[model samples]
Target: MRIIQLFQVALVLMLLALSNEGRVNGERGDRQCEFNPSLSPRPHSVSILEFGAVGDGKTLNTIAFQNAIFYLKSFSDKGGAQLYVPPGTWLTESFNLTSHLTLFLEKGAVIIGSQ
Candidate 1:
């Protein structure tokens, strides 16, 4: 009985030591892989208003949209480009998207298709 109790205690202690070591190693690995925003290339953002997009829900902004996308395409080599539509109603026709372009719409922003 004495031998059995000692063996069980030894086994439990070994498991505890191994688990603690694994946890320490896991924490160290996580620290090594931590995210650093400055090390990564940041995408460029441009608001539709900068391209003369009038979001009054009445003005047709087809040309503005086209110009904005064309301008954003210029920055495709530097990470990517993001087109931001601010919070307002934007009336425009259909527009095409270029490669490496992201369209971000803020809350309460609406795009109405006009005939």
Candidate 2:
């Protein structure tokens, strides 16, 4: 009798797990990930080049990135800002990211860490 009860409990747990196998958090069907570019549009936009960042992938752009964010910090009250990175490989050390600033990277643009 004890063996029969244990088997029944195991069967019930297995059925519960199988019922939710194809669902995510009780939601039916699969969901695709999506990114909407215009979800948070900034009123101000500035390019990294404006701050003297060379995208040759060799120049250490730590100062450039720092300066850019520092400059854009002023726009925090005016609907935020976007720091645009053009198509190239940018090398930089660690830098601080300010609030209300979006680091926009264009196609083919990449940022590499410097030693």
Candidate 3:
């Protein structure tokens, strides 16, 4: 009975250690593979805003979109801020992305525009 209990405990510990190590490895891989704004055409160090988003499927966040563009323009001179769009279907007339900007499109992202 003592040997069986010790073996069970050892098995659980081994499983926990392996699980932790695997989780760490997965995180490192994701971080390493993600897009970094530093490598964009121009790097920036500025702040942006996301305003007036409808947060629905029908309406496009015009003010929010424009705000993002304008904010990017503000930091264009200094260069190092990334404009991030949250995961959703964004309907906009147009979007002017800057060289220093980084656009991260998650899987199944949908951006609609009619011009």
Candidate 4:
């Protein structure tokens, strides 16, 4: 009976130690993959408003987003570009995004999908 109890305690301790080891390794891995967008700034920046986007939550801005992306695609060879979304409720439909572009949203900015 004594041997059985000791064996059960040992098994529990082993499992706890293994779980702690995995948790510590996961924490370290996450730190390495962390990204801060503010740290890396885009070369060129343009606002969605420049493309005639009205962010009143009722306005459909799908074309504005599409046009903005199409215009920004030209700067891809220069150094990439950024599409800045100001604080407001922007209703838009699905649109294609280009490569080497950063879609930066300001604080309080919300994007609502319009199907």
Off by over 4 Å in 3: 1-49
Q: How many residue pairs clash in all the candidates, one count each?
A: 0, 0, 7, 0
Question: Which ranges of candidate 2 are over 4 A from the true structure?
Answer: 1-34
Q: Which residue pairs in model 1 clash with each other?
A: none
TM-scores, all models, native as reference = 0.62, 0.68, 0.49, 0.67
Model 1 per-residue lDDT tens digits across residues 72-106: 99998988888899999999999999988878778
Worst 10 residues of 1 by lDDT: 33-42
TM-score of model number 3: 0.49
lDDT of 4 by residue, 6-108 (tens): 9999999999887777356556433443565455777999999999999899999999999999999999999899999999999999999999999988877
Q: For model 3, how does the per-residue alpha-carbon lDDT over 1-115 read when each residue is reduced to its tens digit? A: 9999999999999998877773564564334356545655446432222466543457866667777767776665676466655566777777667665666555545677755
Better of 1 and 3 by lDDT: 1
Cα miss at 106, model 3 (Å)?
2.8
Ranking by lDDT: 2, 4, 1, 3
**What does the lDDT read for residue 38 in candidate 2?**
62
How high is the lDDT of residue 22 in model 4?
Answer: 34
Point out where model 1 deviates above 4 Å.
1-42
The ten-residue window of minimal lDDT in model 2 covers 30-39
